[model samples]
Target: MTSVNDQTQIEQETGNTEGESKDSVKQEKEMKPEESNANSPTELSKLTKIVKHSKPEQPLGFDGFKKQYYRYASKFGTTLNLLVVGGSSLGKTTFVNSLIQGSLTGKKTAKTSDFMQHRLRMTDGDINFNLTILDTPGFGEKCDNSNCWKPLANILVQRLNAYFENEIKACRQLPIVDTRIHGCLFFINPTGHMLDPLELYVMKRIDRFVNIIPVIAKADMLTPEECARFKRNIIKDLQHEHIQFFHEPGKSIEGINYGMPEPFALIGATKGMQSDSKNAIRGREYPWGVINIDDPQHSDFCAFRNFLLYTHAEALIEKTHKVIYDALRTERLNKLKSQPNGFYTSSKKLVEEYMKAELGRVERSLRQTVQDKLQEKENLLAYTEKQLEAKHKEYEESLINRCNELKSQKQSLENLVRSDKTKKHSIFFK
Candidate 1:
């Protein structure tokens, strides 16, 4: 019996020991998961990983960008006016069509024997452009092109005069739609020689009033060597004649090689065909391979395009306003001042009208200035009056408080005197 009792005791001890070992193993296993979590990357690191892998929201596409630009332009009231001036059959019409990116078949600038202006409005992407192509027909075509440039000169002067007249008028439209020629693109025939007399004459006459950009028309007619020589000659001639092309002062002239030589060699092609490389080139087909109009090696059309539309559009407009138009206005005013009073009766009346308008403008300005000063003074006086009123109220309140304190002191003094008398009487009675 003793041996059996000892065996039961041993079995209970072993079972308890085994259960403790098992519990310790299970605890270690649970703790292992927590240890692993602690060893892993931090929460911030995991968030960074997610951010690096996730796709960001895309930006607005071309159409959306154009609409946004248009909205801003409309709100600000801005427009580009381009005037294309070139002789007939010099790809002027073709160039205009290309600029507007239209397929108006057989729609050319009015090709009259005389100089004429054709008006067309075009909108590309977000930009709205008012295009005026001044076609000078029979310019160099005549045998005696002596005074051929006079018509164009007259047109520019007429525009200036009209603008001046509008300025002198009492009532005028708001944000006046400026019709003055901002830019003139003069086309030179690709003769691989210097500029013709007619081009030089026209350029000299209009360069002061407008920004002239010389173009070597039909550049593909000349070879590369010939084109280079032609460009050099044109530059030399322009420098000798003291003619100025479109160039902005105080602006960097870097990275514009093809345009710096002055007359940009250009080619305009309205037709195109697919080549073996599956590229549609707008060029004339020869026995050899194709010559792309946009290819820089072939022509400077791309360079000229960038210069016209991107680099100098705003500068041209600014120059016209500040330099050309302002100078013209000053000259007109000076002329009006110099004219005799009695002679040229119509001229005298016009000058008188202009002077009257000027006087009215000055009077209105002076009146406005006086009114503004008076308003400022009134505001200052009102502020001072308010301050004075507030100070007066404070002073009155302080005076009333002091008066009350004095009255209280007087009553207290009277009471004290009566108490002293009472004390004295009590002492006497005692």
Candidate 2:
């Protein structure tokens, strides 16, 4: 009976151990799938979903990237997109080339025959821009020629549309391009001082498209009195048409001013290597007042390049915004005005309220944007301060370490000298 009981107990223990082994194997299989899935790239997709639905992580750490971005943005905050347009031989090509090459000498490479459209690109590190210089056919002498003015105007309109279409689309969701016509440099010869009726017609047509900047080219050919008279006359004519001018004094370094009815006085091109014209005048200047390639300062073209890049970019952005706003406002007003009397009166009221609310929202958004920019500036300043403090601390620590090392060396030297003296005295006394 005892022998039978022992065999039964052994069988029961064997069964129990086998069951435990099976359980352990099942547990390992269950955990293996989860462990493999956890290390899979597909797991990132799940994390992305969670992040999308959750609050964004705050910006962390100030570094070179942040500093560089802010520095570039601040420097180019008012970058303008400017389109230079005018009759041929009016120094449009020369002025543009000079501006880009920083001197009239470099404009030698530009083709100046008839009307040709040329595009130039300028870049500073990561910031890149293009200047489209449309050399429109000269209009005054050929204005009445239907073949000339009509085709020119049509082409101008089409090109203008295409240019703006591309610009608007590219900047549809960006903050970089904000202003159009940051300024215009319209080249008109001062020697003539007479407005070509054809030029005037073209101006009227393009005026609806862009802001006018009446630039008096070849001012060096005109006497000071003549320059003054030309400026006044141009200003008077522009004012008569209700056009405004933003002027910069001949040698002023002030921020550019906008929205004046009078034409600004700018000597777009000058003659000779005179100090006044070479150093003070901001635009491209030619040697001996020639708008041709013989000028030497032509190689220093970066200044003009910078000007075009800044102005063109700003103007493109501004103009785009204006176009959008105008279109929306006009469409809304037309729809409201088209309604029949008493028809959908409640709808009209609701629409008006909605428009007003949208306008208010835009204004509030602008205010909030300004506040955010200010906060960003403050953050940048604080970051710079912290960096400076860290550098200062590091320098102080280095200096302290250097002083301690010198102290240790000096003590070693002093001990060596004292020992040598003691040895000499002991020998002498002995």
Off by over 4 Å in 1: 1-72, 104-127, 249-261, 340-430
C-alpha TM-score for every candidate:
0.57, 0.42
What lDDT tens digits, residue by residue, belong to model 1 across residues 1-430? 2233343354354332233333322221223333445544542222221111111143224347667866876555444556666665888766765555545343444455654566665566655656566655546777766456656666676676677777766897666778777887888888897888778877886777777777888888899889889988987888799987776433455755323435688877666567678986666566887777778888888877787667776677887889888997887778767778623224345445544664576569779999999999999999999999999999999999999999999999999999999999999999
Top-TM-score structure, candidate number: 1
170: Cα error in model 1, Å: 2.1
Determine which window of 10 residues in candidate 2 has minimal summed lDDT: 47-56
Question: Model 2 reaches what TM-score against the true structure?
Answer: 0.42
**Candidate 2 local lDDT, 1-430, one digit each (tens):** 2233343354354332233333322221223344456665554322321111011133222345667876775556434445565566666665555455445332343435555545555566655555555554444555353233344334433434343444435455444343233344566656546655554655554454455567665555666567668767776766576643443334423664322333433334422233444543344444554332222233213333433454334544555457633543454446557977623333335444544664576569779999999999999999999999999999999999999999999999999999999999999999
lDDT of each: 0.67, 0.50
RMSD of each: 34.5, 32.6
